[model samples]
Target: MTARTARQRLRDDAGSAVVEFPLVAVLIILIALTLIQCALVVHTRNTLTDAAVQAAHTASLEGNEPEDGATRGAQLVHDRFGEDYAVEVDADEKGEGVVRVRITATFPLIGLIGPSGTLHVDGHAIDEETW
Candidate 1:
């Protein structure tokens, strides 16, 4: 075979970049989407924690009613994630001034596939005078 000319080699290399560009672009887009999903998860967790803290504070202000505190916390969670989600609340030992709230969400990851993720928020609104 005859040796290739500079012009011929240049022409051959032109479309190589175009072919590789789309594959790389697709990979980059996927990575960015995954990162965004992770951020969303973190944000959801933070929201749950805030709701729990508010509920604990409210319950303590009213009385040492753990059930009331839990109901309030769960209501906040339901407001955000909807009533379909799971919520559980419990109070710590007397003096700890803390309450636990767990929120579970069931969502689809892709077509016909999905998994459940739980967000647990522990809020300690103990009175300064107590524990």
Candidate 2:
């Protein structure tokens, strides 16, 4: 091929970048959004788990009732995440000197809104009286 033809061929590929750039950019943006959503879900799960554990420990203490633990867990969730998340917490003895706290809430599918009663986590602690 002549140099002139080669130059024209190179120029033809120029606008191709403009079209490809948007496609690549859109893909990158989608990947970033997915990562962000995953992080949000993980953070939410961790927070709920921690709150449940704290509540369990509190209720396992001497002279504490399971209802008190449930109330405390709900309060912790409300304090951290506000009323946006409808969280239900329950505490009960598991028949082995263990107190278990269960937290059930919505799974954050999109921006902290999803199906209700989908996510469940449990926390267990030894009862102080059993020690």
Candidate 3:
């Protein structure tokens, strides 16, 4: 190619990086945000599940009541996540000497806030009285 033609092509391509950068950067940023949100949601779910299980275990300790388990679970959630998460815990006997704890809460959709009643988790333990 002629030197003039090459220079003209270079001119046409000049500043393309500046224009393309924001576009690609925006896409990358969006992907990163989505991944981060997914991680947060997973973490929240795991935390809730852990709390429920612990509550069930506590309540299964012979003399403890279902309400006690529910309260413990709620406190655990509140302590870890603070009051930002609207969590509800319920515990009851689930037949055959088993205790079940159920946790319902809002699933984080955006930055730890989301529609209510979007998450549900259950934990079960054998009642110590049966042992």
Best by TM-score: 2
Rank order (by TM-score, best first): 2, 3, 1
Model 3 — which ten-residue stretch has the worst lDDT? 108-117
In candidate 3, which residue ranges exceed 4 Å CA deviation?
A: 1-11, 113-117
Task: State the weakest 10-residue window (summed lDDT) of model 1.
Answer: 104-113
- How would you encode candidate 3's per-residue C-alpha lDDT over 19-130 as one tens digit per residue? 9999999999999999998898899889999999999999999899999999999999999988866788999997799999999988767865555337999999999999
Off by over 4 Å in 1: 1-11, 96-113, 127-131
Model 1 lDDT, residue 32, Cα: 91
lDDT of 1 by residue, 1-131 (tens): 33567667877766788899999999999999788777766777788778878877766663556666777887888998788766776654364654444434443343223665555567756643353
Q: How many residue pairs clash (N, CA or C atoms closer than 3 angstroms) in each of the candidate models, in the order given?
A: 0, 0, 0
- Return the clash pairs for model 2, or none: none
Candidate 2: worst-modelled 10 consecutive residues by lDDT: 108-117
TM-score, one value per model:
0.74, 0.87, 0.86
> For model 2, how does the per-residue alpha-carbon lDDT over 1-118 read when each residue is reduced to its tens digit?
6999989898776679889999999999999989988898888899999999999999999999888889999999999999876888989997889999999987668765554337
Candidate 2 vs 3: which has more TM-score: 2
